[model samples]
Target chain A: MAKVLMKGNEAIGAAAIQAGCKYFFGYPITPQNELPEYMSKELPKNDGVFVQAESEVAAINMVYGAAGCGVRVMTSSSSPGIALKQEGITYIAGAELPCVIVNIVRGGPGLGGIQPAQSDYFQSTRGGGNGDYKLLVLAPANLQEMVDMVQEAFDMADYYRNPVMVVGDGMIGQMMEPIEFRTPVKRELPSKEGWATTGTKGNRKPHIINSLFLDPQGLEDHNIRLQKKYKTMKENEARYEAYNMENAEIVLAAYGTTSRICKNAIDKLKEEGINIGLIRPQTLWPFPEKAFQEIPETVKAALTVEMSEGQMIDDVRLALNGKIPTEFYGRSGGMIPTPDAIIDKIKEMLGGLK
Target chain B: MLNDKRIRIIVGHYGSGKTEFAVNYAMKLIEQESNVALADLDVVNVYFRSREKAKMMTEKGIKVISSAIGHDANLDLPAISAGIFAPLQDETCQTILDVGGDATGARVLAQFKQIINFMGYDMFLVVNANREETQTKEGVLRHIEEIERQTGFKITGLINNTHLLRETTLEEVLKGQALVKSVSDETNIPIKYISAIEKVAQTIPSDVDGEIMPIKMYMREEWM
Candidate 1:
């Protein structure tokens, strides 16, 4: 297919449909509204269903219901809206159903602003919902990567029978970029007939989709099973990109929109004879510890940059595990970290190292 | 140069570079016309609105009107300002209404239909062939009809402002021109401007139908 210019939100919507997503349930929210709007228009033409549910809470529950029946389903919203869907998300996670959730994050705590922010790093990677669950969280840095990730998210969700959240800030949702919908890598998906709530013939027993295990032992067993799936995800699905890691004095760790800014800063720093490397995590959940392992011995420090007040830094710290001196620079409430600001922070980190 | 129409209403598919074109068109008009006002009546999109550039345009002496609350506020409320009436009433000030994308966005113009029709405005449908919805001639015509039906206004001109953001090339512009040219021929709506960035605009052949408007991207960031 020919490449076409698209806003990030619409491109994700198109990607979902192309990935054979037949059901969409979402409520309107800025920065991510275009996804629902695009789906509302195009889904029906492809013999799919698009529902503008009454609220974010209702939307996620609808996704749970659809996923229970073994169909590719998705729901999208901004930060505050995603917060409202938390209870349902936890329910879906507990049920071990497959679905895709998109959080085009905006600044928050309480509807902070409609601009882009990486403040939801904790909400996304740490599982905003309840009890012993993990979402396969994919954080894409650009529109093209985002489009590819959305399709892959659906497969990962089904392959593991778990929810996969594709989180990008408002900048990724609103910006325009040229993208092509390439074929996603095929996953060896298990048959849904084994567990789906599809009606059974008289010969077989009925399949029940439920997260409730009233007995403590049953709940513990369920939690144990879920943890094993999450562990497999951590081992097999961790993804990251190492840029300019050849020889570096300082390494910058960032993801999503902030990672793109770091790349720009690294390029500018190179022109000044300052070598700066970057480790950009494509999957936020697993944290891609392998990328940090590749950090050259010459690197003196690591600076984690973000659009929030240092949420992702903790993950970076955990990934590095005291291997290097790590520092942080961030701006919260819709303020983006520019390349110049990143450069200054890198230089400041170098000065402190001296 | 734009036509002598005092009110130039810019409408098109979402992500068709309408906001970018409107900002550039306002700046170009300010060079010739002393009083130029650009009203961002786009209610559909939250980000990338022309109002985001209000401060810069205001400093350049172009009157910028957006939401009633404020231009700087990143609120997505669909509140059109009463201030939009100022330039519409004052014929001396050339007004450009940067309407939101598609038929849904064109519905906002229906509210001002009486004054707009009475004053006689030129509604230009900006076309970007790269946008999936309006990539084909049939798709462009369908949008034209839907927008016309929604606004109860005839689209008098077509602006080929197709681009792939900073990666736009002369070949892309020519491809869009061919698509828009076919639409223009069928609809009999004159192709008013073939808008492109300076580099691509200079390379366009003179045989193209519309005046080549070299636009400096205002709504997009330098790094974007």
Candidate 2:
């Protein structure tokens, strides 16, 4: 359990191996490319399957095929390549397959340019692939969480018979940091193997994996079952990190790589006698909205810092519900604001209090 | 026209070498005895990004303002200091804004309308034909439109950034020139320079001003 310096992406690969994931299928994409490369070398030593897929399209389907067999499966890609995988992802979700996907997001509407970008904030949480299906999404801010969350992602994927995503950005993928997920959390073995494509015994009916239900009633039943699962996920899976809140006059909220900058800013302002706190979101989809409602009354204003032009800020606005003044600060397209830059904003917002 | 500022807006899609381009071009302008400033606005990225160049640019007397870093070394969140905006009024200094990716990036320039008008900026839209987004002429024009729309400023020229990270050859540059030719044909934006991998860019004629990637940049002590 000793901590080791690892880029977030490599940590994910290590976490997956520890979680008993024996197959990885993916193509080359910046930031997250190290995950697949690590798998190509490491997975085989563990007697696992590692395929350098022909394309992002090919990779995700290979994941779909591998996951359908009820073995742990995963893939990694950046935003543009992730976009290509969406079609396959939707199919995976619809079929109720359990798999993990890591998107080391780079900027994009379409090949929006590589380097870390959080413009895909909406894509990951709001269901990047499509449909009424929900994927369990975990947003990791550092290498430690990158190692930890991939295991959690696999557990959640199996526990709920759903897809899970560990969404980080290029910084997390490339930057090495200390981590300690050497011993993964013990997870319950999935109980539904008779229905899984694990080798069938003579007595049970063969499990046919299909999202298509020919009858309207059956499809409605499937959709309703998925909705109920989503509702449970929302209720039980909201996680976040809150810092320095008792007398915070200004709260800076961010996630993933940007939150580290926010934490740095908060530390500086705290030293300078400014009462500032931070809220780093750990799960973006089942956004821990209740955190805002539970904010200390001494807080006067809050703001959102992200790697995009005010995408995640909208969520902060929803969570706070105008109870306190909320302003937004961000720089987009792989541009990260320094802690000092954010502290200036905090001071300016606090300066008006008198 | 000696007072004509060497102000340039080096704009490009991500990984297009715009940051290096802005740095080198500003150094060149500074070498020619012009006071220079490099304004780093890219916030959408975190590593290997443009704003880190600010510390060195500041060391060179090229006034650097990102969100200017405070004493503690975090960004200062930009509000231009007095008199810096009216660059035309100043006789000797030049400014370069290294934007992030595409339109979303150029949107930050809206904050600098004062400078844009004071010194009519020379907007250079770097066209990296190898980039997935900028591979076609339509893609290049579309990028140009996005930057213009976001910054409310026009790109006066283009830089053909056709280098494949390490695979770029002169033969590849010729093909990229064809891609730039199509952009020129469709949008009438002339290519001011064409950059390539070290060897390819090095072999270009001196008049071309082709750019080479720096092997290293001095890391700032307290990096932001």
True contacts kept of each: 0.68, 0.03
For B1-224, candidate 2 gives per-residue lDDT tens digits of 12333677788776566766667766656777656776666654345455566566667777766543432233223333343454534545577777766787778778777757776767888876665467777888888888898888888777876654444567656666788877777777767767655566666655543333331222212222
* CAPRI-style class, candidate 2: incorrect
Q: Give the per-residue lDDT of model 1 (tens digit) for B56-136.
A: 899889999999989977887899899999999997889999999999998999889899999998999999999998999
TM-scores of chain A, one for each prediction: 0.98, 0.95
| lDDT, candidates in the order shown | 0.91, 0.75
lDDT measured at residue A11 in model 2 versus the true structure, 0 to 100? 73
- Local error of candidate 1 at A8, Å? 1.4
Angstrom error of the Cα, residue A174, model 2: value is: 0.4
**Runs off by more than 4 Å, candidate 1:** none
- Docking quality of model 1: it rates as medium
List pairs with backbone clashes in candidate 1: none
Give me the displacement of residue A20 in model 2, in angstroms. Answer: 1.2
DockQ comparisons of all candidates to the true complex:
0.71, 0.03
